[model samples]
Target: MTTASSTSSESSQERYQHALMNTFGAPKLILTRGQGARVWDEDGKEYVDLLGGIAVNALGHGHPALVKAVAEQLSTLGHISNFFASGPQIQLAEKLISLLQPASGVGSRPAKVFFTNSGTEANEAAFKLTRRTGRTHLVAMKSSFHGRTMGALALTSKEAYRAPFEPLPGDVTFVEYGDAAALAAAVTDETAAIVVEPLQGEAGVVVPPADFLAKARAIADEHGALLWLDEVQTGMGRTGAWFAHTASGATPDIVTLAKGLGGGFPIGACIGLGDAADLLQRGNHGSTFAGNPPACAAALAVIATIETEGLLERATMVGEKLRDGLAADPRVTAVTGEGLLIGVVTTVDTAKIAAAALAQGFIVNNATPDRIRLAPPLVLTDEDVAAFLAAWPTILDAAEALA
Candidate 1:
C-alpha cells in the first residue's frame, strides 16, 4: 500500500482521492499555504480567497494573533477534561456570555455556556437543552441549516440532507422562513423551541424582513416556547456585529455560535439565557475536546483582534463595496446579505460562475444553482477587492459563454 507521502510523484488531487472519503466530491485545488485572504496551490499558483473557508477564516489564514494565542496556550496548558476547567476555557465562556448580554436582555437572569468542537455539536447541545422543557415538539424555519449531526439534522429543514437519514430524533415542524404568520401557525404551547438562523446562510444568504426576528420572539413568547437563534455562520462579526440578530433587537433564550468564533481553529459554543440557562443540568451532556485551552485561547484572540482592529466596521465597509460593485453588473440580478456575508443572484447558473472564478484566480462558492455566496475574510484588503472587481466582468463573460 502506497502512503500519501510515499506517492510524491502522484498529483495532489490523485492522492486526495485515494486517501479521503467522497463526501465533498473531488478536490477543487490542492492548496499548500495561505496568507491573509490569498492562498497558494501546491503548484504555486495563487488565488484570492473569497469564500474564507466557508466563513470560518474570520481573521484570514495564518493570522499572527490566532497563531500566537494557540501556541502560547498549548505550551502553557493544553487539553483538560471537563472534570477540571482551564483559564482560557472559563474566560472564553465569560466572554461569550458578555457578548450575548445585549441580545439576551434577560435582566437579572444569568447566562450559561456549553462549549463544543463545532457548530453542529453546539446545536446538538442546544437541542438537548430544549428537550428539557418537557416537550418533544420543535419548530424550525424552512431552508434553515443548523448542522449535519443526527440531532441537528432533525432541526435542519433541507430534505436532501434529512431524507436518507430518516426518522430523525424529535417531532420537528417546518415553517416558511420570513413568514411570521406561518411561524405562529406552526409553533404551539407543546413546541419546546423555535430554531431559526437570523439570516439564512445556506439558503443563499437570505435576509428576512426587518421585523421577522422580533415577530419570532413575540410568537415564541405567546406559546411559552424558547427562541433559539442559530448564528453558526452569521455570528462573531461575520455580519459586522457580534451576532446578526443584534440589529433586530430580538432577545433570544438560546444562541449557538461557531465558524468565525475561533478564527480558523475549531471551536463553538451553546449559550442558554435566562431560564433556558438551567435546562441542561450536570450529566445531561458532555464532550471530550469541547473546551480545550488552545481552542479557547484561539477564540479569545479572535474576539480581541476583532475588537482592536475594528473588523466589524471593516466587514461593513468592504461588504458594501463588493455588493455595490457586483450589483452594478447587468449579469447580477440581486445582492443580499450584511457585512461580508454576501449573496449574488445571477441570470445564469452559478456553477459556471464559480468555475469561471476559479479559472480566473479567485475562490468563490456556488451556494445554489443560481446563487453565488461570498463570505470572504474580514481582513480582505482593498487591493484584493479591487483586483476581483477588475476581473469581475471577464468572469461573468466566461460564465455567460459557458451558459
Candidate 2:
C-alpha cells in the first residue's frame, strides 16, 4: 500500500523489479513529474529531458493545450469502439492527410488513414495492406527498426531481435542502408512494398543520401510496388518538418506514423496514398481502442500547438545550435540528423557518456556504443540548450575518464 506522497526512487525501483517485466531493464530515474523540457525524479532531482520520451513528446510534458484537449475529450466522450466515429477521430485523420500533402505546390494525392495505438501497430496494418498486392516480398533496409510486434519484427533487420523468433513472416530482403544500388537490386516486380525510414532513428539518427529516398520511389514505381516510409520517429516535427521524407521529394504510397503524433498520448497512423489508399478494405483490419476520442483530441492539440507556436522553425534553429556546439568538441567525430532529432558520434563509449549526462542533470541516450542521440522537445528553450552546451565539455571529459 504505497502512496504517491510517500514513495521514493529506491522504494519504487524495488517495487518495479518485482511487479513489472524486465523488457526495458532497470528504470533510469523513476521520474515523477515533468513540464516543458524538464522533469523531476522521485527524489526531486531536476533534469533537462533531451530524449523527449524517445521523440514522442512533441509539445513537451504537461503542455496546456495537450492537457486541456485530452481532459475535455475524455470527460465528454472517451473510448469508443471502431463501430462508431468521433469528431476528433475524423478531424485527426483529415489533418494527418493534409500534413502529408506535398510541399512542392503540386496537386496532392488521394490518401486514407487507419489509426492504431502505437507505431508498431501502424506498421502491422501497413504490412497487411502490402499483402493485399498479392506479392509477398518486402524490401527493407539493414539496421532498420519497425517495432517489436510479430509482423513489424519480421520487417525489422536486426538479427539479435529476430533470432529468438524464427520463422517470421517471410519474404523480406535486407539491403545496406543508404545504398541505392543495393536497393535497386533487392526490389523486383514481385516485391509488394519497399519500406524505409526517412531517418534511421534507432541506428543513431542515420540519414541516407539526399537522393536515396527518391531512388527508392523510382525503383518501387518501376516494379509497380508500393513505396512505404516508416516515419514513426521522424514525423510530427521531430526533424523540423511535418515529416522527414518531405526533404527528399519522394511521395511514398504508404506512410506509417506514431511516436510524436499524440504528443505522448499514444496514437499512430498508417496512411495509404493514391491507388494504395483503398488497399485495406472494411473487413481487412480493425482495432477497438484505436483513434479513441481522447487520443485524437490530444494529437489535434499537438498539431495545432506546433502550428501556432512556430515550433517547426524553433526545432530547426535550436537543432542547428546544438549540433554545431556538439560538433565543435574534439571528442565528437560527427554530428548527424536534422532539426531536434540529432546523433553525436563521439570518441568515448556512449554508455559512459549517457551515464555522465545523467549525473550532470541532463538526459540523453546512448543509441550505440559510439553514438549519442538527442531528440529534445520542440519547446526546448535557449536557456536549456545553453546549459547543456556549457556542460558538454565536462560530460565528455567524464565519459573519457570512464573509458
Candidate 3:
C-alpha cells in the first residue's frame, strides 16, 4: 500500500510539473487532508501548518461551517453575473462595511465595497479606482508588497518581481517604509493615492512604527491623496482585530482585503470610504464572477465563525505565547508582528530552518533569507504551540548544522 501510494504521488507530481505553468517552481508536499491546524501528506504524515497557506486558512482546513456554507450556497445558487446581485453578496458587502468602521468612536462614515477573486485583483481594482481621481501619480513604500498583478506589482517595492514585467504602470513613487518624512516628501497634491500595508507580511511580517499609519493618514489628508491600506494579510481577525490600521486609530480612504477573508475560499474586497466611495461610478469597474454566491457565503461563514469562536482574542493570547517562546532562543534575533502573523529573524539560513522544520512535522515559511514567518490558523490550539515550542531548539540546531 505504501509503495503504491508513493508511486501514485510521484506520478501525479510529474504530471503536474509537465502540465502546469512553472510559476510556483516546485511542490513541497502533496497535501491530502487537513483539520484544524494540522494537515496530512499523501504518505499520511501529519504536520502542524504554521504558515496557514501563506495566511489564507484562518479557520483551517475542512472547517465544517465553511464547508457547509459553500455547499449550501452552491446548491441554492452558485453564481450570477455582476449585473445581478445575490443575498450572500449583499450580506458580505454590508458585513465588511460594518467591520471596516474605525474603532475610534468617530461618527459613522459611509463606505462602499468592490469584490474580487483574489488579493491581487482586489488591488488591481483599487488601483483603477485611484485613477478615477484624475491624478495618475501614486506613492508606495519600499520593501512593501501589495500583490503580483501588473497594477498591484507597480506598487510593490521588490524589483525582482517587477523587473521581468517592466514598463509597469507609471507615475508611482516608492519611498522608504516607516519613514514618515520620506512619505510626506513623496506625496504631492497631484498624487491620486498612497498604498501601504499596515504590516508588511511578505517582507517578513515587518511592523511599522506605532505612529506610521497615523502619520500616513495625516500626510494623505495634507496632500489630498487617498490613504489606501492593503490589509490582505493582516485584516479579518488575523491580527486579533477587525483591521490592523484600526489599532492606530487611522481611518483609511481605501482598503484592500483577501488572504484569510474567506478562510481559504477565493474572495477579495476593495473598500472605499467617505467621498472616495463614489469615485468608482457606474461602468468604471466590473468582475464577471467576483461576488458569486458560494464565495460570498464562504466569506460570511468565516467571519461568523471567527466572531462566534472568539478566535480574535485567542489569536492574541497564542501569538504572545509563540512570540515569547520563539524569542527565548538565542539564535532567534528578533520577533515581530502581532497575533498569529509573526516573523522570526534567525542567525541561521531560513531555508535550512524551513527544511528542518518540515523534517520535524512542522510547516513554516522562509519568507526571506533570514526571516521565518508564522501565520498559523487563528484557531491554533495551545497544544500545537507547546509542541512547536518544544521542538524549536532541535529545528534550529539541525538548521544551523545544515547551514
Candidate 4:
C-alpha cells in the first residue's frame, strides 16, 4: 500500500509535470515546508536559506506575524475587488505615504499610491501612470529590468528579454546606466519620465555613483520629466533604509515597490508623490486584487515587524559582518550593497560555487557568471551568518576542485 506521504510526494511531481508548462525548467527540489530562513525539501533535506526566495522572503517562510495576518484576514475578508476599499487597504496606503514622505516646492505635493499583485504589475501600473503626464517619451537605463509585462518590458533594456516581444511600447530611449552625462542627454522636456533602479538588482545589484540619482533628478527637473525610482529590489529596508534614493536627497516623483513588501505574500505599491500623485486619476487605472484586505494585512505585518523588531538596524549590523567575512575569502574578491541585500563577486565559477554551497547545506544564488546575490531574511540570525561564513572556504574549495 502507498503511504499517504509517499503517494502525495510522488503525485506532486507527476501532477506538476503533467499540468504545468516548462517555463523555469523542472523544479530544483520539491520543497515541503519552511520556517525562519530554513526550508526542508520533499526528501527532508534541510538547507539554510541564504537567497530568501530571490529576496522576496524578508521574514522567511511561515513567519508567525505573516502567517497570522494572512490567515486572519483571509478568514475575515478575502477579496472585495476594486469597486470598494477595505480598512487594511487604506491603512497600508497611509502607512506607505508616511514612509515615502512628500516633497515641498511650488509644484511639489504629497504622493498618492496604486497597488498591484506583483512587482511586474506594479511596474505596469507605473508605466501607465507615466503616460498620464501627456508626454509619451521615457528614458530608461541600459541593462535595466523593469518587469515582464509588455509596457514594463519596453522600458526594460535587455535585448534578450525584449527582442522576442517587440516592438515594445515605443518612444522610450535607453541611456547608459551610471553615466550622469548620458542620462542628462537622454532626458528632455518631451520625455514623460526617467526610470531608474538605485541599485540594479537583476543586473547584479550594480550601485551607481553617489551623485547619479542626484544627477538624474537634476536632469529630470531641468526637462520637466518625472523621476521614477523602481525600488522593487532595493527598497523596503533592503539597503539599510526605506529607499535607496534617500542618500541623494532628491525625492522621486514616482516609486514602485514589491518583492519584500509583503514578506512573501504578493503585494506591490506604485507611489506617486507630489505632482506625480495628481497625474493618475479615478478613470485612469485600476486592479481587482490591487489593495485587497489579505495582501494589505500581510504588508502591514511586514512593516510592523520590521519596525517593532528593529530589523532595519539589525540588517545593517549583520550585513556588514556577512559582506566583510565573505570578502576576506580569496575567492570572493568584492562585496557590494548595504544591509541584508548583498552582491558578491567571485574569482571562481559562480554556478559551481552556488551548487557547492547548496551541497554544503547553504542556499545562495548565482546572479551571473561571476556574481552571487545574498538577500537572506531580514530576520536571519547571527548564528546563521557565522555558520555560512565558516563554510564559505570549504564551499569554494569543493567547487574549485570539482571544476
Candidate 5:
C-alpha cells in the first residue's frame, strides 16, 4: 500500500477532527516521526521532506547538536521571563550583531535585537518600531507574504488574505515588486519604512533584479524611510549566505527573521541597525516567550552547526545540482532561486505535481498554480539530491497525465 494510504489507515482521523480546530484545514497526515530530511507517517512509511517544514527546519529533523542543545538548555533552565536575561540570550544577540554588520558604512555599527516567538511576531515588533519613527505611511511589495498579524498583514499585498482581516493597521501602500520605478514613486518624506523581501518566497521564489535592493535603499535614503527586509523566509543562510540582502550590500534599517533562525526551534528576531536601533524606546514592545533561554540556545546551536559543518557552501553546491537537474526536463519551463530554496515552473498545474510527488513519497509545496517550491534542509546530501532528481521526471509525467 502507498505511504499516504497506510498513514490514513493507521491514524484515527476522527480523533483529530474532534480535538483540533478547523483552521489549517484537515491534517495532511498523522506524522509519527522524523530524522534528518525525512519523516515517517504513523503507518511506518517514510518520505523525503523537501519543504523543510515550510523552510523552518534548517538542520532538518533531529540534528544531534540541536536536540542536545534544546534538551540541555531546557533541563538547565526551562523558561526565564524576559525580566531577567540569560547567557544564551546575550550570546545570540552578539552573534546576530556580528552577522548583521558584515560590511557596514562605518565598520559595522553597533546594533540591538528584539526577540519574538515567531516570524509574524518579529514582524509585528518591527512594524511597531516603524511607528516609533513618528510616521504612519509604510510601503510593501505585491505578492509578498509577511505574516498574519494585523500589523504585518497590513504590509502584505495579497487581497484574498487581507480582505478578511480588513481595516488592518492602515496607511500602507502596495507596489509592484522588482519594479524600481514604482518603488521610487511610492516613497515620500512621510513614509516610515519600505519593507521588502530579498527574494520573494511565497511568490514562487521570485528573485528581484540584483540592483533592485540597492534602488530601494537609495529611495529609502532619499525619503528618510527605514529600509526593512523581511528575512523571515529568506534569511539565516537559506540563500547560501547569512542574509539575502548581504550580497546586495544594502544595509537595511530593519531586518526581521525567523524560519531557519532557530533551525526549527521557534525563535524570531527584529534587528535594527544604526539610528534605527534606538527608535523603539522602552515599553515599545514585549513578548513573554521572546528571549527565553531555551529558544536562544537552540538558535545558537543552529548557527554553530551551520558554521562547523560548512552547510552554507554545501547548500550552494547541492542547490546548483538540483536547479540544473530540474531544468533539464522539457516539462519544466523554468527554474529560479539559489541554495535549497527553489521554485520550478511548468505548463501543468503545480497542485497536480505536488499531489503526484506525495503519492510517490516526496513532499513539496504548490506555491502557485504553475509553480512548485522546494526548500529542503541545508543538510541535504548529494545522495538526497540524486534521489530527488531521479524521481523528478516520473513526478512530472504523472502530473502531466493527471492534468
Candidate 6:
C-alpha cells in the first residue's frame, strides 16, 4: 500500500497522466476532502463545488445521514446476492415507485425497478428491456447523450461518440430534439421505444417546449412504442420535482435514474410502469452489486434527508436566484433550466469561463463551447450562491479577455 508520505512530493497531475487512461484527458485537481458544498484540494485550497460531482451529490459531500446509513448498513450486511432480498433494496424500490406519481400527485402507477450501478448501466438495462418488446427499432433525439455502454451508445445521437464505436446495436434512429413533429415522423409502429432525456443535461441543460414531452407520449402511444425518459441527470429532486417529466405532464412507460439517487454512492434503476413492467423476464438481467445494502441505504438516506431538509423547495428558490444572477451579466445570452441544474448561454468561450471560475476557487462545468452548466448541490447555501454571483462578472471578464 502506498502511504501519503510516499507520494506527497509528486504532483497528482503527473501521477494521473502516468497511471491512468487518457480517456478524460488530464486531471483537473487532486481533491483531498469535501464537506457540505465545499471541497479542499491536496494543497488545502478550498473551492465551492458548483458542479456537485456533475449533479450526483444531492445532499452535498459527506452528509451525516448518508454517511451513517452507508456505514451501518455495511456493518450489518454488505453484499447479499440478488437471489436473496434485502430490506434497504426493497424499501428503496418502493420509495422510487411512490415518487413516480403524476403531476396531479393523486396516486402512482404500479412500477417495477431493476437496479444497476450507474446512470449508464441503468440506461443499458432500459435498452435491453426495449429489445424484449419484440421491436428492434429505437428512436432517439439528436444532441442527446444516454451513456457510453454499447446499447446506450446506440441510443445516443452524437456522431463523435459513435464514430469509433461503430457496429453499435442496430436500428437506432436520431430525430431533432424538442421537435415534436420530427419525433412523431421518426417513431413508427416498428419502433420499440422512444428514449429521451427530460432535459438534455450534456447538451447544455437544454429543455424542450412545454408540450414536447406530452407530444412524444402521444406519438409513442400511436406507434405502440414505449416512452422511456432518461432521468439520470434530471431526477431525484434536481429539477425541484421527484422527476422532471412529472412537471411536463408526460407519464412515461419507463424511467432510467441515477446520479443523485444514491447521493454520492453509485446506484441506478430502470423503472418500468404498467405493462412495461413485465417486459423483462427473470433471467433477462441481473447485477451482482446493483442493490447491495450500502448503496440502497445511501439512497434511502438521501431521499429522507431531502424530505426532512426541504431541499426541493430550496432547490427551486436557489435556482431562481442563480439563474437571475447569471443572466444579469451581458456576457450571458440566455439561461435555462429548473432547480439546481442551470445552463448559462454565453457568447464567449465557455471553456475559458470554466478555467476562470476554477482559478477563482469555484468548480463548474463547460457542457459545450457556448454553454456553461451549473448543477450545484441541493444543500448549497444562500451564501454560496451569493459568492458565485459576486464573482460572476469578474469571471466572465477574464474569460472574455482570454477568448
Best model per TM-score: 3
Deviation (Å) of 317 in candidate 1: 0.8
Per-candidate TM vs. native?
0.97, 0.97, 0.98, 0.95, 0.97, 0.97
Give the better candidate number (1 or 6) by lDDT.
Answer: 1
How would the candidate models be sorted by lDDT, starting from the highest?
2, 1, 3, 6, 5, 4
Worst 10 residues of 6 by lDDT: 101-110
123-224 per-residue lDDT for model 6 (tens digits): 999999998889999999999999999999998888899999999986998988999998988989999999999899999999999999999999999999
RMSD of 6: 2.7
lDDT of each: 0.93, 0.93, 0.92, 0.88, 0.90, 0.92
Evaluated at residue 41, the lDDT of candidate 3 is: 90
Clashing pairs in 2: none
Q: Global CA lDDT of candidate 2, please?
A: 0.93
Q: Please say which candidate is ahead in TM-score: 4 or 6.
A: 6
Q: Output the TM-score of candidate 6.
A: 0.97
1-403: candidate 1 lDDT, tens digit per residue: 9755435435666877889999988878878899999998766778999999999999999999999999999899998888998999989998999888965565556899999999999999999999999998999988889989999999888899999999999999998999999998898889999999989999899999999999999999999999999999999999999899998989999999999999889999999998998999989999999999999999999999999999999999999999999999998899999999999998978999999999999999999998999999999999999999999999999988994
Per-residue lDDT tens digits for candidate 5, residues 1-403, read: 4666765654567778878897777766778889999999877778999999999999999999999999999999989887898999999999988887873342568689999999999999999999998999999999999999999899889899899878898699889999999999999999999999999999899999999999999999999999999999988888898888877888788999999999988899999998989998888799888989989999999999999999989888988999999999998899999888999988878999999998888999999998899999999877778888999999988988893
Stretches off by above 4 angstroms in model 6 are 1-10, 103-108
lDDT, residue 131, candidate 2: 95
Q: Extract clashing residue pairs from model 4.
A: 109-274, 110-274, 111-273
**Clash number for model 4?**
3
Off by over 4 Å in 4: 1-15, 102-108
